[model samples]
Target chain A: MNKRKSKNVFINGAISSEFIGQSIAKHQSKTTIGAHNIFLGQVRADEIDGKKVSAIEYTAHEDMASIKFHEIREETFSKFDLTCMHIYHSLGSVKAGEICLFVFVSSPRRKEVFSALEYVVEEIKAKIPVFGKEIFEDESHQWKVNS
Target chain B: MILHIKYFGLLAEVTGCNEETLEFSKNSVSDVLSILFEKYPDLKEKDFQVAQNNEIVSKEMVISEGEIALLPPFSGG
Candidate 1:
């Protein structure tokens, strides 16, 4: 429909289970949507050099990251038969095992969402200029790199 | 020309400032980078990308109008 305007996609901290539940509840009114696919990215407790990761502090070049997010949304909409889509990423510190990224896509059928969801998530991981500092349990930190 | 330069992630950690306006008499992005490397030798050992006017740019790109940013590898989910 092309009516999806650029929206703020960042939250100050982790995305709570309550928020996810409410989002699903809000979509109950959209009877036209038959299937919804969701992807939740959890921070891993990665260990490096005898240190365990405790949390991740996220930062972004906000203006550019927002613009990139909008482009990814537009591209996904054009490529898939999605009724609606939403993406949210965490800013600030998110503890390990907490949700940092959430992508929800709805369609009339199940198959469209299956592929569209992955596409959007992959594009974001590759393109967005968001950075993370992995804080170790001992208070030391290292930069995270996507590979 | 005076350019607004931004640093993010590891680049900011190395540069010690999030952003600053610098006077550079360079013709290309690489030329400006050389000056930065001279000022902060630690930066040369790390990997990063350059963005001009919010677009990722190569070192050969000409230095032109707009803000410049030095971005480290992205780790966003």
Candidate 2:
């Protein structure tokens, strides 16, 4: 509610390092922010019963997901002293070791960003309605259940 | 009444499609599920949550007008 753009957070493919870099660079002008914390989620190639995970395909109820993201943003801003916050998640196939989720939180001090980042990430895991299908190298797939 | 149902993740695979509009006179969430189960038997075996108007609803909640989503366990980061 605090002037956040309430933008769509889904990215089409893997989050490129260049894109991540540009996001960080954009914050340079905000001299009020003295600290920033980031959390990146990478797909892991796990061998399950001899089949290795090749990639993860993500899907979501877009309308509901957007609403949830906006709620999280508002709650975060209200709960912490954050100057700015941004979140992005991949939508399509992202190979193992590729980045699928990115969360960045900035504040005038280090302590707020640290706790705010964890709270935001955990809320997304428990509340957001995004799903992932883990595709094996041989083409078999299984649903990913977060722990 | 007519209801719009949206499916996400494994629920979509179980339902064999992502979204559909079904005509029903259901009074509660469970009644709606019974109809869905008859159409897609696999849906009964999958674990998921039901959301109505962007908020997760319990099975006892009365069916309401607006978009509804069948969400599988969240795997988002």
Candidate 3:
């Protein structure tokens, strides 16, 4: 296993945007890639039938989440011909409108990069065991677990 | 047998503790859940996912003399 792949797995309450960008740059160096695409997921503050969501507190069953993430990483590599990929998610609290996730993928061409990015996002949403606590501006909250 | 069950997220709110040990007959995950529901009737309506020893486990997983069980809702990506 390469250092790039093994170290891409992270579980933290917060991550630096520059670090993510650097990681992508590092991965892109080896590939004589024509294109790179990145997706950044930000939390949105919205009204839920009258209650306004102000922030989100993300949590996870860490033990299970780590294992699930490792599995997804392997599956993504098999599904895409991408040079490399990196996935990072925020744990603990993230305010509304703050970026919560960053998915970066690079391939030899643009077409594969787009597809791989989408696949990684979808797989993370469907399979990862991270939960979100939608905090209303008024301080009320609700738990959101991806189905 | 007495088994320690840990609670996370909303389950922690309902149980008011991170973990507790309850005595039960040698039973499966489902059986232990039923026992929990009987004691805390409020949890009957809440959806729960069980894990045994830090791994996501099915209801069919058997409980022996000493094991850790967790009742947490699906909170993933």
Which candidate number maximizes DockQ? 1
What TM-score against the true chain A does chain A of each candidate get?
Answer: 0.98, 0.98, 0.85
**Model 1 pairs in collision:** none
CAPRI-style quality class for the chain A–B interface of candidate 2: high
Query: Which pairs clash in model 2?
Result: none
Q: Which candidate is the best by TM-score?
A: 1
Give a tens-digit lDDT track for model 1, residues A72-95: 999999999999999999999999
Regions of model 1 farther than 4 Å from truth: none
What's the distance in Å from true for residue B29, model 1?
A: 1.0
The segments of candidate 3 whose C-alpha lies over 4 angstroms from its true place after superposition are: A1-16, A145-147, B64-77
Tens digits of per-residue lDDT, candidate 3, A45-75, equal 7678799888778876666667767777777
**Candidate number that wins on TM-score, 1 or 3:** 1
Question: In candidate 2, residue A117 scores what lDDT?
Answer: 99
- Over the stretch A1-147, how does candidate 2's per-residue lDDT look in tens digits? 267768889999899999999999999999999999999999999898999999999988788889999999999999999999999999989999999999999999999999999999999999888899999999999999997
Q: Per-residue lDDT for B40 in model 2? A: 92
In model 2, where do residues sit more than 4 Å from their true spots?
none
